[model samples]
Each structure stands twice: as structure tokens, then as C-alpha cells.
Target: MHAIHIERHGGPEVMTWSERPDPTPAPGQALVRLGAAGVNFMDVGARSVGAPGWSAPTGLGVEGMGYVTALGDDVEDLSVGDRVAWFYHPGSYAEILAIPATALVRVPDDVPDETAAAIMMQGLTANHFTTETYAVGPGDTAVVHAAAGGVGLLLTQMIKARGGRVIGLVSRAEKAATAEEAGADHVLVSSGAGFEQRVKELTSGEGAHVVYDGGGTATFRSSQLSLRRHGVHAYYGPFMGVPSLPVTDLPNSILLTYPTVQDHVPDREALVTRTAEVFRMVQEGRVVPRIGGRYALSDAARAHRDLESRRTTGKLLLLP
Candidate 1:
């Protein structure tokens, strides 16, 4: 099998495409022939910062979509040739991967492999963020940082589908347009001064009901200011480097919450069920996974470089 492995953590250059022995599925696992792999900021964190849960010299992707090539002895209800997508599994940046049956969700025939791969982690994160963590509701207003990024775009659409008004914060005018096109009610360029004030004005001085902040460190303080009294602040990612905040630093009128999909949705059955709902939304055209760029498997390093430079928008994928 051909896979991209990081022999040691450093930069994108550390990712190397090499041949390795094919993996054999253990009991309750299935072997999948990879079609597309979703490249996420978490993977970049793993390569750049020695992210937790991944060892040195490891295969680097966390999610993908593929077909079942074989199944282990105890695997049932899934057969060889089943088309599926999955997330939170390791070593997915390969031509083949061995995953537990619980991690795999059958992709509807109408959904393409790339869309399935792109949505697994980002869509599920958006689902859990809006539905479980913050509970966005009709007539509610929310703020989404990195509003043109992969999860941001999906989160924007999902919030709109739920009848919530979204204020998208982006770094550039181009990204503002992208966020607006993704169904954001208003787009604010976060590059200028008084951006937090602009968010307050957009929400008619009430501030946002919730703030979905993924760009950590740089936007942390401003995100807190954008929220209303007793509003929830869901911090899902740390793409800008982790922010340090003292519990006492929170506003007296607001509540602070930092939730990750892994922490909020721990049950395998619940994860699968929630992910399936998002997939159904995609199949029915209620939510669309935007493909910003595509690269071949061997060019994975270049893909990482593009992502870290902030030169890409929406989801980037590696075709194997």
C-alpha cells in the first residue's frame, strides 16, 4: 500500500509518500480501498506541532471515503464492495485502510466519493457544534470565524438551514464573498478595526446568541465580545495556535464553553447516527460540501503547504 507518513514532525516537507506492506483487518474491522482523503487542520497540527494521539513516523490522515475490499471475521451487516466514508480513524492517507465497522457509514449512491470524504469530519463537526454544543435556533444570530474555510462554509449553510442568521468573519474581501455565497446573512472582514462593533451592529445591538470560533488565539477575545449575555461560545479548533484564557477572564454576563466533536459526541452509535443525518442533508441538497482544491496523493506535501499558507478555501482533498 502507498501511504503518506511523517517520519518526524516538522513541516509539510516531512510528509513522505512510500510503499508499505498491506494491512490485514483484525476481528470487527474491515479493509477499505481508498478513493479520497480529507486533509484537515488537525492533520496540519499533527505534522507541525506533534499533535496528541499520533506518534512520530505515523500515517497522517484522519478521515476518508472508499470501498470495502474485505471484512474481518466478526464484521457483519457490511459486505465487500460497500461504499463508505469515515472519520476519527488513523492512517487514512493510504491506498487501503483497516477500520472498525462502527467507523464506516455507507455513502448514498448519489453522493460522490470526494464529497463524502470532504464532509465526514467537517460536516460532523458543524453538526455537533450547532446542534449539540450551542443549540442554534430560529431567529438566533451567531458568529462563525474562518467563515470561508472548510467547516466554516458547512457550518454557515447548516445554521441557515436551521433559520439562524449568521455573521461570517473572514480575513479578506474575497472570503467575505465566499461566506455570503455559502448562506451567511452578513459577512464581516476581520482585518480592520471595530470588527467586533460591526458584529454587534449586525445583530441589532443584542450581540450574537452563540459564537462558533475555530481560529484560536487571534480571534478568541473578539469572539467573546461578539456574544450576547449568557450566550454560548463554542471553541472547536485552534488553527491559529491555542488560545490561553483564564476562567475568571470570561464576561460576568456570558457563559464560556469549549467543546470538540470527540468530547461532545463520544458514543460510536451517536456519532454514526448524527453523521448519517448530515449525509442525508447532503444527499437531499440541503447542505453542499464545497471542493476548494484537489491534488493527487503523491502531492500531499504541496497540499499541506497550500492549506497552511491560507491560500485555499472550502475543503481540500487528496485523490488516491
Candidate 2:
């Protein structure tokens, strides 16, 4: 089989195609013939920082969907030929993978292969962020950063579905429309200043009840100011670099949290519950992921290039 093997940490070019031996499923594992792979910033960050998990001479992906060709002993969760999707199975840049049975989730027949792969990570992240983290509800005013990006789009809709109003902040005019379409009550473009003021104006001076700042460092400060006193500040991504604000800066009863899926879903049982809800939302049309771009497995480098270039929106997938 051929896989996207990374020989070093650096640019996308480091991810090169190579031939490798076919892997057989081990006990409690399943050998999946990948149909598509989801490309995310996680993969890019791993590549950039030389994350020990993806050190040299390693394959580059963590999420994908495919058909199981074989199942190892003790794997009663699924069977051969069952269509499934998974997250957290490293080396997903290959045509096939030997993934833990626990990571597998049944892909509903109604969902397309690309959609299943594209939505798993971002969808689940958005699910827990809005549903469990701050518990957004009616009359809540929320602010979403990078509003048209993968998680942003889903998060915006989920917040609205729960009856919360969203003020989407984007870097470009085009993304503003996408976020609004996803149910953001208002869209604001950052001009390197005054985001908090804009939110206050939109909410008629009440400010937002919660601010989802995935834009990382660049938007971190403005995100706090955008929130009303005693509001929730959910800091999730580090796209612009990891930045932290002193607790003293948040006046009143403002709440700040840094939630991670690893901490939220400590085991397979938790993952199953989260995935189930995200899948239901997609099947019910409450959440729709935009398939921003598709790339051939051989072009994994180009995929990484486009993703880091920030020239695309929604989810990007690699066809295996």
C-alpha cells in the first residue's frame, strides 16, 4: 500500500508518497480501506512542530472513513465490510489503516463518504463546545470567531438551534455571508480593532453572553471585551498562537474555560455519545458542513498548502 509518509518536520513538501507493507489487523483492531481522509490543522500543527506522535518516517492523518475489510479477535463492535468512520487513528494518510475497534463509528447509509470524514472531528468538537461546555440556551448572545471555518460554521448553527443569538467575526467579507447563512444573527469583520464595540452595538449595548474565540491570540483580547460582565469565555483553538489572559482582567462574574475533547470524553463510551449527537444533527439537517476542497491522496502536500494558506473554507478532504 502507499501512504503519505513524512520524513521530516517543515513545509507540506515533507509529506511524500511512499510504498509500504499492507497492515493486518491486530487483536481489538480493524483494518480499514480508507475512502477519504479529513485534512485539519491538527495534521498541520503536528507537521509543523514535529509532534512526537508524527515524528519523521510517519504517516500524516488522524481522521478518515472507510470499509472494514477485516476485524481482529475480540472486536465484536463491528464486522468485515461494515462502513465506518473514525477519529484518533494516526497514520490515516494511507490507503488503509489498522485502527482500534473502539475508535470506529458506524457511518449511516444516508451520509456520503466525504461528508462523514469531513464532519467527524469538527462536528464533534462543535457539539461538545456548544452543548456541554457553556450550555448555550435561548436568549443567550454568543460570539463565534473565524465564523465560516469548519468548526465555526457548525458551532454557529448549533448555537442558533439551541435558540442563542450569534455574532460571527470573520476576517473577510465572503466568510461573513457563510456564517450568517449558518444562523449567525450578525456578522462583523475585524479591522484590527473595535470588535468588542461592534458586538455591543449589535446587542444594543448588552454585549454577548458567551464568546467562542477559536481565532486564538489575535482575537483573544477582543473576545473578552465583547462579552458582557459575567459571561462565559470558551477558548478553544490556537490558530493565531496560544494566548492567555489574566483572570483579573475578566471583571464581574465572567467565566473562562479551556475545554478539550480528550478531557471531556475520557474513554470510548464518551466518544460514542458525542459522535451520536453530532451524527443526528447532520442527519436531521440541523448541521451541514461545507466541503471546501478535495485532494487526491498523492497531493497531500498541496492539501496542506491550501489549508495553511487560509484560502479555503469549510472542511477539506483527501480522496484515498
Candidate 3:
């Protein structure tokens, strides 16, 4: 098997596409033959910041879509050749690897392999953002930063499906079309200059009921400013470095939240339920993930460079 190995994390060059012995399934695990692997910010964080649960000289991804080629002892919930997608499983940037059989989400027949891998983490995060974080309702307005990006596109559609109006913030003019197509009631160029004022104007002077920011520091303050008094500022990811916004600066009684899908999934059952809901939403035509780009298994380095460039839109994947 081949995988992207990072011996000493520093830059994209550290990820070397190299050969490794095929892994054997341990108890309750299944050997998954990789189809597609999702390249996410978390993977970049692992490579850049040396995030926990990883040491040097390991694979570089945690979410992917694959097939069960073999199963270990006592694993009966899933069988061989079953197509599945998973989140938080290590060594995903490989041709084959072992994963807990129970952690796999059965991908629907209609969702393509790339699409399934792309949505597993991003869509699951979106599910919790709207349904749990703030419970966006009818007549509510939301400002979704990075509205053309992976989770933002899905999150925008989900909020709209739940009857909330969206004022989507995009970094460039090129992204405006995608955000609007994703059901953003209003799309504004998120130049980080006067964007909060634009959100207020879009909402007729009453700020948005909820603000969903996945771009981190680049859009943090504007996202906070777009919120109404007592509105929810849902800070999600750290794409442009984490922000140091002061809690004292927020309006009185406002709800400031930082939700991660990993932290929200309390147990195996919760993980299964959240993933199932994301899959169901896709099946119901409520959430659609845009596959911005796909790189060959050996070209993982190029994928990381493109993702950090901020020029690419939607989900990026690696085809194994």
C-alpha cells in the first residue's frame, strides 16, 4: 500500500507519497480499500501544528470513502465489499487501511465516492451547526462566511431548508455565484472591509439571528458584527488562524459558540446518528457538496497547497 507520510511536519513538502506494508484488520476492525479521501483543514492542522494523536511518520488524513475488503474477529455489523465512509479514522491518506467497522457510514447508492468522502465531515458539521448550535428557525437571518466553501455551502442550504434567510459572505466575486446558487438569500463580497455593515443593510438594519463563520480570523469580527443583539455567533473552523475575539466585546446576552463535530459526537451512537442525518439530508436533496478539486493519491502535496491558497472553492479530495 502507498500513503502520504509526514516524518517531520512543516510544509506540504513534508508529505511524501511512499510505499507502506498493507495493514491487517485488528479486532472489530475492517481493512478498507480506499476509493477517495477527503482533504480537510484538520489534516492541514495535523501537518502544520503537530496536533495530538499523531506522531511523525504517519498517514495524513482522517476522513474517506472506501470498501470493506476484509473484517477482523467479531465484526458482523458490516460485511466484505460494503461501501462506506467514515470520519476521525486515522491513516486515511492511503491506498488501504484498517478502520473500526462500527465507525463506517453506509454511503447511499446515489452519492458518488468522491461526494461521499467530501461530505462525511463537512456535512456532519453542518448538521450540528444549524440543528443543534442555534436551531435556526423561520424568519431568522444567518450570515455564513466562506459561503462558497465546503461546509458553508452545505450549511447555507440546510439553513434555508429550515426556513431561515441567509446572507452569505464570499471572499471574491467568483464565489458569489456559488453561494447564491446554494440558497443564500443575499450574497456579499466578504473583503473583510465593511462586510458587517453590508450584512446589516441586507437584513434591513436588524442584524442576522445567527452567524456561521468557518474562515476563522479572516471573517471573525465581521461575523460577530453581523449578529443581532442576543444572536448566536457560531465560530466553527480555524482556516486563517484562530481569532482572539474578546467575550467582553460581545453584546449582552449574545450566544457565542464554538462547535466541533468531534466534540459533539458523545459516543458511537451519536456519531452514527449525526452521520446518518447528513447522508439522509443529501438523499433528500437538502444538502449538496461541491467537489472543487480531486488530486491523484501521490499528489497530496499539491492538494494541500491548493487548499491553503483560498482560490479553490468547495470540497477538495484525493483519489486513491
Candidate 4:
């Protein structure tokens, strides 16, 4: 099997495409013949920082969609040739991956492999953020940073579907248009000065009821200021860098929460159920996964470069 591996943590240059031994399903695991793999910021972080507690040369990729070619013992519910998608497992940037059955979610037959691959990580992250963390409701207002990015677009659409209004923050006018198309009620260009003031104006001086911030340090303070009194702030990612927040700087009455998909949905069954809901939305045309770019598996380095350069929008996938 061929896979992308990072011999040492550094940059996109560290990624190597080479042949490796084919993976066999272990107990409680299934071997998937990957059709597409999702490229995420976490992959870059893992390569740049190495695993939290492991040594170098880690296999990259966190999520993908494929068909089950073989199943381990005790995996009876899912048969051979089951189409599935999954994340939270590692070493997925390959032609074949050995993933635990617990991590797999059955993909709808009508859904394309690319869309299935695109949704797992970003879709689940958006689902947990809006529905679980803030519990955004009808008539509530939300401010989403990086509004045209993968998870941002999905989050904005999900919020809209739940009757919440969203204010999208993007770096470019093109992205603003994309956000608008994805159901963001208001779009703000974060590169300009007075971004926070604009957000405040959008909410008629009251500020948003919730702020979904993923841009990290650069927009952290503005996110705090964009919220109304007693509003919730959900910080889900550090795309720019880890944000530093002082307790004193926060509004005394507001609630601030840093939630991750893993933290919000810890049970495998619950994760699968929520993911099914997301997929249903996609299948029913209520939610759309914007697949911005596709690259061959061997071209993972270029994909990483494009993502880090901020030249792409929505999801990027690798065809295996």
C-alpha cells in the first residue's frame, strides 16, 4: 500500500509518499479500501508538532471514506463492501486503512465518495459546536470566524437550518460571497479595521448571541467583543495559532466555552447518530459540503501547501 508519512515534524516538505506494507484488520477493526481522504488542519498540526506523546515518522491523515474489503472478528453488523466514513482515527492518508468498527459511520448509497470524505471531521465538528455547545436557537444570532472555511461553512448552514442567524467573518470578498451562499445572514471582512464594530452594528449594538471562533489569536479578542451580554463563545480551532485570553478581559456576564468534537461527543454510538443526521441533511439538500479541491494521493504535499497558504475554500480531499 502507498501512503503519506512524515519522517519528522516540520512543514509540508516533510511529507513523503512511499510504499508501505498493506494493513490487515485487527480484532474489532475493518480494512477499508479508501476512495477519498479528507485533508484537515489537524493533519498539518500533527506533522508540524508531531504527536502529543509519540516519536517521529507518524502516518498522517485523520479522516476518510471508503468501502470495507475485510472485517475482523466480532464485527458482524457491518458486512463486506459496506460504504463508510470516519475520523478521529489516525493514518488514513493511504490506499487502505485499518479502522475500528466503532469509528465507522455508514455512508448513504447516493452520497459520493468525495462528499462523504469531506464531511466526517468538519461536519461532526460543526454539529457538536452548534447543537451541543451553544445550543443555538431560533431568533439567536451567531458570529462565525473563517466563515467560508470547511467547518465554518457547515456550521453556518447548520445554524441557519436551526433558525439562527449567522454573521460570517472572512478574509476576502470572494469568501464573503461563498458564506452568503451558505446561508450567513451577514458577512464581515476580518482583514479590515473596525471588524468588531461592524459585528456590533450587525447586531444593532446588542452584539451576537453566540460567537463561533476558529481563526484563533488574530480574531480571538474581536470574537469576545462581538458577543452580547451572557452570550456564549465557542472556540473550536486554532488555525491561526493558539489564542491567549485573560480572564479579566472577558465580559463578566458572558459564558465562554472551548469545545472540541471529541469532548462534545465521546460515545461512539452518539457520534454515529449525530453524523447520520448531518449526512441526512446533506442528502436532503438542507446542507451542502463544498469540496473546493481534489488532489491525487501522491500530491498531498501540494494540497498541504495550498491549504496553509489560505488559497482554497471549503474542503480539500485526496483521491486514493
Candidate 5:
């Protein structure tokens, strides 16, 4: 088997499609042949510098969907040939992987393989933002940063599915229609910090009920300013830049939180439940991922280059 591995962290150039010994299923593990792998900003971060649990000499992917070819001891629930998807199993960039059975969820027949892979990470993060982070209700307004990107598009749709209005923030005007197509009621094309006024204006000067901010430091304060009094500011963006804030700087009596997707699915039970909801939403057509690009598994470095350029919108996929 071959997988993308990095011996030292640097840029996309650091990733190499190298040969490796085929892995056998270990106890409580299931061997999966890769169907499709989702490319996320988190993957970029992992490739650029090592994140926790992602040290050098490590394979470079976390979310993907595949078929179970074999099962290890005590893995009674899953059978060979079953379609499965996982959101957080490390080293998912390979043509095959030995993932713990507990981390894998059966993919519904209604969901396509690539679609299932695309939605797992970004979809669940969107679910966490809309539900637990702020519990978006009918008529509530939300400001979603990077609205044309993967998480942004899904978050916009989920917010709309719950009957809430979305004021999408995009870095480019050309991406506005994409965000609008995903149910953003309003789209603001702003580079950095000046989007709060438009958000306020759209919300009738009352400000938004919540701001789902994945737009790092430059836009952090703007996201907060776009919220109403007592509104929730969910800052999930850490890649662009991480900003330091003093407690006294918080405005509008709003609540600030960094909602991680891991908390949304702390265990196998939560994983099953959350993924089921995301799959049902896809089957119902409430959430449709725009597959912006697909690259061969060996050519993943180019995919990373395209993503880092910020020219592509929506989800990118890797085919093995």
C-alpha cells in the first residue's frame, strides 16, 4: 500500500506519496480500502506544522469514507463489504487503513461515497455550531464567515434548514453567488474587518443572533461586533490567525466559545447519532456539498496548493 506521508513538517511539498507495508486489522480494528478522503483546512495545518497527535513521520489525513474489507477480533457489528465512514481516525490518507471499529460508522445507502466522505468533518462541525454552540431558532439571524468554503456552505444550509437567516461573509465577490445558492440570505464580500456594519444593517440594527466565525484574527472582532446583545460568538477559525482577547474586550454581553467538533461527538454513541442526522439531511436535500475539486490520491499535494490559494470554493476530495 502507499500513502501520503511527511517526514518533516513544512509545506505541501513536504508530503510524499510513498510505499508502505500493507496493514492488517488489529484487535478491535477494521481494515478499510479508501473510497474518498475529504480535504480540510485542518489537513493543511497538519501538513504545514504538526498538530497534536500528528507528529512527523505520520500519514496526513483524518476524514474519509471507505469499504470494510476485513475485521479484527471482537469487531462483531461490522461485516466485510460494509460501507463505512469516519471523521477523526488519524492517518486516513492511505489507500488502506486499520481503523478502530468504534471510530467507524456505517454509511447509509442513500448517501454516495464521495458525499459521505465530504460531509463528515465539515458537516458535523456545522451541526455543532448551529445546535450546541447557539441553538439557532426561527427568525434568528447568523453571520457566517467564509460562507463559500466547505464549512461555511454547510453551516449556511444548516442555519437555513432551522429557519434562521444567514448573512454570509466571503473574501471575494465572485464567491457571493455560491454562498447565496447555499441559502445565505445576504452575502458580504469583504477582505477583513469592515463587514460588521453590513451585518448590522441587514439585521435592522439589532445585530445577528449569532456569528459563526471561522475567519481568524483579522475578522474576529468584526464577527463579535456583528452580534446582538447576549448573542453567541462561536469562533472556530484558528488557521488564518489566533487572536488574544482580554475578558474586558467582549462587547454586547455576548458569549464567546471555541466549539470543537470532538466535543460534538465525544464517543461512539454520539458519533452514530450525529452522523445519522447529517446523512438524513443529505438524503432530504437540505444540505448538498459542492465538490469544488477532486484529485488523484498521489496528487494530493496539488490539492493542498489549490486550497491554500483560497481560489476554490466548497469541498475538495481525494480519490484513492
Candidate 6:
């Protein structure tokens, strides 16, 4: 089978479509034939500078949906031909994968292959941000930075599904309609700082109840300024820039947290539960994922380049 491989960390040019041996499922594992793979900024980070678990001479994907062609020992719960999807399995860019059974979730019949693949990683992250990081209640206002992006769009819909209002922030004027179409109550076309006053004005002098900040250092302070007293600042934008904050400098008695999607599904049971909820939301037509672009699996390098440029909106998928 062919897969995307990298020998050294650098630009998207480092990615190569290479041939590899077919993998056989081991105990408690299932062999999946790729349907589609989701692209994320983290994949770019892995290819460029490298992350803790990702290094050179490795495959470059973590989220995808496929069919179970076979299952290994003790994997009695799943059968051949069952459609399944996973959010985090390293080396998912391959044509086929032998993923642990515990990490695989059955895809609903109503959900299309590409949509199922698209929602797993970003959907779960938005679920965690809305539920645990800060419970979004009715009538509450939220400032979602990069509101037209993958996680941002999901966050906006989920917040609205819970009866909250979204104050979306987009860097370019052209992206405003995209954010509004995803249920953003108000969209601000401003980059870096200075968006705080607009957020306050939209809220009628009372700031937002929470800020889902993914804009990094450039808008970190603006996100904080847009929040009300005791509001929650959920920072999950490590791909842009990391900001340093002091407790003494924390304004408005607000709380700050860096939430990870993994924590929302720490075990198999949690994974199943959270995934079911996301799928349910999709079934209800309340959370529809917008596909920004699609690329052939062999052309994943082009997908990476588009994501790094930050010009694309919604989710990008790789089809095999």
C-alpha cells in the first residue's frame, strides 16, 4: 500500500507518497481500509518542527474513517465490513491501518464517509470545549476566534445548539459570511488586537461569558478583554503562538484553561460516549461540518500547504 512518509522535518515538500508493506492486525486490533482522512494544523506542526510523539521517518495523520476488512484475536465485538472511524491513531495517512479496537468507533449509517471522517477530531474537541472546559448555557455570549475555521465552526454550532450566542472573530472580511452561515450571531472582521471594544459593543457593555481563543498571542489579550467578569478563557490555539500569563495580570477575575480533546475521552467508554453525542448532533442536523477542500491521499502535501496558509475555511479531507 502507498502512504505519506517524511524522512526529515521541514516544509510540505518533505512529504512523499511511498509504497509500504500491507499490515496485518494483531491481538485486539482491527484492519481498516481508508475511506478518508481529516487534515489538521497539528499534522503541519508534526511535519515542520515535529511534536513529542511525532518524529522524522514516520507517517503523517491521526484522524480518519474506514471499513474493517479484518479483526484480530479477542476483537469479537466488531466484524468484517463494519464501518468505523477513529480520532487519534498515529500513522493514519496510510491506505490501510491496523488500529487498536479500543480506539475505533462505529460510524452511523446516516453519516457519510467523508463527514464521519471530518467530524471526529474537530467535533470531539468542540464538544470538550463546550461541555467540560466551560459549559455554554442559554443566553450566554461567547467570543470564538477564527470562527470560520474547523474547530471554530464546530464550536459556533455547538454553542448555538445549547442556546448560546456566538460573537465570531475572523481575520479577513471575506470570511465573515462563512462564520455567519455557521450560526455566528455576530462576526467581526479584525485581526490581532482591538476587537475587544467591538465585542463589548455587541454585548451592550456587558462582555461575553466565555472566549474560545485559537488566535494565539496576537489576539490573546483581546480575547480576555472581550470576556465578562468570571468568564472562562479556553485557549486551544497552540498552532499559532503560545502566550505567557501571570495570575496577578488576570483581568476581571476570569478563569483560564488549556483544554485537550484527549481528556474528554480518556478511556474507551468515554470515547464511545462522546462520539455518540457528536453523531447524534449530526443526525439532528444541528452540527453540520463544512468541507473546505478535498485532496487525493497521495496529494496530502498540498492539503498541508493550504492549512498552513490559513486561507482555507472549514475542514479539509484526504480521500483514499
Instruction: Give the winner by lDDT.
Output: 6
User: Model-by-model lDDT, in order?
Assistant: 0.86, 0.85, 0.86, 0.86, 0.93, 0.94
Query: What are the models' TM-scores?
Result: 0.96, 0.95, 0.95, 0.96, 0.99, 0.98
* Root-mean-square deviation of every model: 1.4, 1.6, 1.5, 1.5, 0.8, 0.9
Candidate 2, position 23, lDDT? 99
lDDT for model 4 comes to: 0.86
Alpha-carbon runs more than 4 Å astray in model 6: none
lDDT of 1 at 202: 84
**Candidate 2: tens digits of C-alpha lDDT, residues 148-256:** 8888898998998899998888878877778888888888887344698889888898788888887767777787788888888898865447875576877557888
- Residue-wise C-alpha lDDT for candidate 6, range 183-258, written one tens digit per residue: 9999999878899999899999889999999888988998888889999999887867899978889889999999
Q: Write the per-residue lDDT of candidate 1 for residues 235-265, one digit (tens) a residue.
A: 7666556777677888637877777878645
For residues 108-222, what per-residue lDDT tens digits would candidate 3 score against the true structure? 7888788889898888888889888989899899888888888889999999889999888888899899999999888888656468888888888878899887776767777
TM-score of 3: 0.95
What is model 5's C-alpha RMSD? 0.8
lDDT for 248 in candidate 4 is 75
The global Cα lDDT (0 to 1) of model 2 is 0.85
Candidate 4 lDDT over residue span 231-311, tens digit each? 888876654577666777788378888888887568887877888888999999888999989999999999999998876
Residue pairs with colliding backbones in model 1 are none
Better model by lDDT: candidate 4 vs candidate 6: 6
lDDT at residue 274 of model 3 (Cα atoms): 84
3 or 6, greater by lDDT: 6
Model 1 alpha-carbon miss at residue 291, Å: 0.3
